[model samples]
Target chain A: MPRSATSSARPAGTAAPAHFDFDGIGTSWQIETPRELDPGTRRLVLDRVEEFDRTYSRFRADSLVTAVAERPGTHLFPPDSIGLFDLYDRLVAATDGAVDPLVGRELELLGYDASYRLRPAGAAERAAAEASGPAGWAADVERDGRRLTTERPVVIDVGAAGKGYLVDLVAELLRGRGYDEFLVDASGDLVHSGREPIRVALEHPLQPGTAIGVAEVADASLCASASNRRVWGDGLHHILDARTGSPAREVIATWVVAADTALADGLATALFFTGAHRLAETFHFSYVRMYADGRAERSRDFRGELFS
Target chain B: MNTRQKKLALATMTGLSISAALAGCATDTPSSADAETVAPSTSAAASSAASTPSPDASSDSGSADASSSTYADGDYSATGGYVSPNGPEEIDVSVTLAGDVITAVTVTPDATNPTAIQYQTQFADGIAEVVVGKDIDEISVSRVAGSSLTSGGFNEAIDAIKADAS
Candidate 1:
């Protein structure tokens, strides 16, 4: 939905106001400070969005993702992409290799190569893909400051976690502009700052275009995954198991609220395979899970601060 | 200032805090799979097979029971065809049964991508020949290596079809 322009910028701690839609992330912002998006800030935000799209878009020809597909090895990178690589390492360490980044080769075998294209459906195709060597999260990937290189020419589909990083950057951009109160959302991964808490409705995986529940948090980040989204048809989606070149089932969706977008993004996917019972041992943040059997569960530690 | 901008500011503040909460350092502890020491190979296969129930199945059926009900039978579900736009298009192909042999295939592009139009023009001819006669379960995603990613898109679309039908 589109947002109507405001007559005047409202001061902080005022009446709850109308929502506005910007750059695809739809949520009216509220803040404790009187910071605003000056011309410089606006340009910076737009530029950063463009940079992110160029770096991670699976379709863009000159996107970093494309470059990775063209040449899979450790190479220099722009700060944004390199930061994500570092975050990938963090996720890998946090999840004990469960969230590995070395699956480019396996992902290609599964038909998720550079173009994000699907393979021709046939027994031969399946057999050939299966016959491909078992390439886990170690096939090819290397990154340094402004340099990223891959071992092989495999598609590095960071769709699983790239958006969150972008959101973090957007928030950082706003903060850099001296705006203390703002909300940054990329698709669904979001981060909030300022005084009053924001209420975010977590979309129901089973129910399209509707939210299952709402969570309230101040100055935090939230990433939601549903067994429902990011999947390929035939029950396969993007959330593949690096070890086998297939999707991770068992857990349907996991929403993790944490302090950073990258961690939240990676944790949301990792949680799907981790399951609810094991969340405490595997995850360090609060989470919620919705299952295929119509069961919605949250971690015992998750603060129930939610909006109606 | 306008009401919209005011709301925007507030929203921004709240959203930032949420992000900050998630920004803490990644924990050193591994999730359950690692804790239980489940071999990645065994768990990977199990997870894949188990994820067959497309999460979107219920939503698809509620839209229209007839198309969905008929689709559940092998006839409408077995169809496999691809439509390529310009560069590479995301397509959905499913297997449906008609009579004894499986027939009917679907190839729809992911409208989200800008190049889907181009993919629709170029990739379909080669893809249709590869998938049409295959069983839904037996259908694999490797027959065409040159145009592989598009095939994965077709795979997801077909999976959605089967999930809706079942």
Candidate 2:
């Protein structure tokens, strides 16, 4: 808790915190730091985020993911994208196919397609969208190094974990350059760095702008998922339970804190299907899960203060 | 652990007001109120606090029954989280301090896996015999009931309590 005023390192002056914000990959990102970020480093950080969008964005025609989706044959997904595939594989297995990257097709069928239209398939959505089995994308797609192939048509959207992964990447960039104490907030998925723990408000699923409680995250990432936001049609939001080609209704919102952002982001989505204890077996995170009825449950390790 | 080459420990504490106030808080439970008090808007305050991982907002103010007490004679409680093969285990510990003596101790473990929870329960039920009446600092958190995951957070809470007391 030593204040900067007493630190010998800043005899000349104290470094006030600075923040850099920009929009990318469908969400805004903010970098919070205690020191001035040089112009070059700022550009590097910005470029890294834009790079991920250009590479994995399913909405963009120029994105590699779109290319893979449009082409049925085998293709290479740039070297770094392999890491993303690895993540998807693990998520598929970890959450019992609850967090599938191949869900892009399901999303598109429901009217959240690349054309930027919200044309949900209508009431018949249940019959038409439920064609694919749970986690079947795992089988449809094959990977060899950077190369990937699918037996049929598919659009892989890293949307769920993409922002989180990029957040980690930017956090790494900051740390690599010697800036230690910082928070990289990609939309709401965030990676916190430094010695002290910060308080994160668990957003209320039903009540917009209201928080269920507060959670603390120290040197870790805090990611949240809510079915209330990003709606396109009747009872539809971004988080589909995979088992059902519709939105998850059991758990309305989840806020999880883990050592990694992408992992935290994925786990938050998984909470819609599984509870705290079951998820604990595969991934390590502290969470607060709010049900549709407003009842909320939290992991014992949750570092933040809970309000009754 | 994914390496994010960041030095969150790098804050020079420049113009830091929170570190100066830590002296008064080392003993009690840090609650949401305390967190909000120091930095009303956790995100903005810490972001404005010159960026040092949000300052120890883990201190829950609701559990401040022993704020006036010290490690020599007071009470402390904290919740710690760790991962086991089952996923994650949360351990909550509350201890009473008498000088260096551990007047009382309670360990609570919460887990998703039944087997993991069993280990957590075993660790909780047996931890008192190892720490109560012993010097708080001397109590080494060895694996108990095969539940090693809960120890890190338990020990962390104890350390937080010790800091508050000493």
Candidate 3:
């Protein structure tokens, strides 16, 4: 709901809402609310974002994830991380390890490393990475509450769903500050808590500046993922399948709407490798997935319209 | 629990069973020619019908009807078949019911093809396309959910690649 004035016209008397825009976690963020955020509230929101980054960012040298990668031992995360790690646990089981957070090492080997090399590893490097890649989340890690224990070093990348979880966290911050109606947009992931539903365009993966469909989100979260977002080498992208240590090729783009942003975001990535029905068994959500061959499939209950 | 709560729970269980049955043989797999028969159960069909309550029925009368309509506590299994892009596929679905409420469900993939098996495994975890050409500008959208708009690190990577090329 934070469209520019020119894009979204307001009535004569009603003033347009204020939008707080910034960049964090390697992506753009825009928070829209009818009431402007006070300085203290804004500080709280930013601090929460920083705390999340400090805990989960694999790119940062000071992040806890980096510490975990450097040493194999028990690490205690903040209580807030309980939801995230739990969600990852469910995602691993539901996706049959295709959506594991352990895919971080696989991404680094493919040249989407911490330094953002963006270069595909050569055949020899690829073979080595594959041989020593993560041995699945269940085999390598043990999580009890906020305590995560690993037998060996593992690069834990929460890229698939961390952004959306951060959005949810920020939304909670806003609500705690008495801002009940707001929209948190972390780049493409969004959580809406307002009364009126916002119409969101589902961008086409193959065609930039164009959309394949539109989803109406109200009091829910909508998250989108595509193979085109972070492309470097031929057929390489961020959404990777841990089973093959390669980018998923079947579903090129996925849009999921759920009760919360974290689930929506994680399910969006899961849709790339797993079917929506299987996920529905564990989590209730609606989705639309576009295949590499250009055909698109949507859930019967997806609250949106697709342009053929 | 109250009669209304019981009915609501029954409806949800029935819906899940129906959805599982339908999703078992839906789309996304290569075609196959495996013909398998799932033994049909009369109780399953009757239970499904009984799960739907009459809207006008009041609680006092509904309670008695619900008590009489309770399903026999047992496990029921059925096989559902549908044709995919590859060929025909079948899924075996079993449900445990207690007091007419489904307590558990298991969908077993019965396809012989490896691809179908893979798809079935994905299905156990958890479409219409009409082509109407409309310009992006015509639709007024408050925001867009797509591939991430931009990442500073990604941009820097692009710049590094450009520098190397030059």
Compare the candidates by TM-score and give the number of the best one: 3
What interface RMSD does candidate 2 have? 18.9
Runs off by more than 4 Å, candidate 3:
A1-12, A123-133, B1-133
Each prediction's RMSD over C-alphas, in Å, is 22.2, 19.8, 10.1
lDDT of 3 at B50: 16
Q: What TM-score number comes out for model 2?
A: 0.61
| Deviation of model 2 at A94, angstroms | 2.0
DockQ of 3: 0.22
- What value does DockQ give for candidate 2? 0.02
Candidate 3 lDDT by residue in tens digits, A135-252: 6787898989999999888989998889999999999999999999889999889999866778998887777667888998889999999888888878888888887787877667
Q: State TM-scores per candidate.
A: 0.56, 0.61, 0.74
Instruction: Indicate which candidate wins on lDDT.
Output: 3
Model 1 agreement with the true structure over A1-308: per-residue lDDT tens digits: 22234422345676543333345211122222334456676677667777777776655688776777676566556766767777777666555555666555455555555454544246776676557444444444555566766565655656557767777887887777777776665545777675655555555565453444556656788787765454545675667666556676545666777888877788887765543333333446666655454445554345442212
- The parts of candidate 1 lying over 4 Å away from their true place are A1-36, A72-74, A102-132, A209-211, A275-283, A305-308, B1-166
The candidate with the higher TM-score, 2 or 3, is 3
Tens-digit per-residue lDDT, B34-142, candidate 3:
1111222223333322133221222232343445535444545565565666787776665544555555555566777545654564444322233333455778798
Could you tally the backbone clashes for each prediction? 115, 30, 13
Order the candidates by DockQ, highest first: 3, 2, 1
Using DockQ, give the best candidate's number: 3
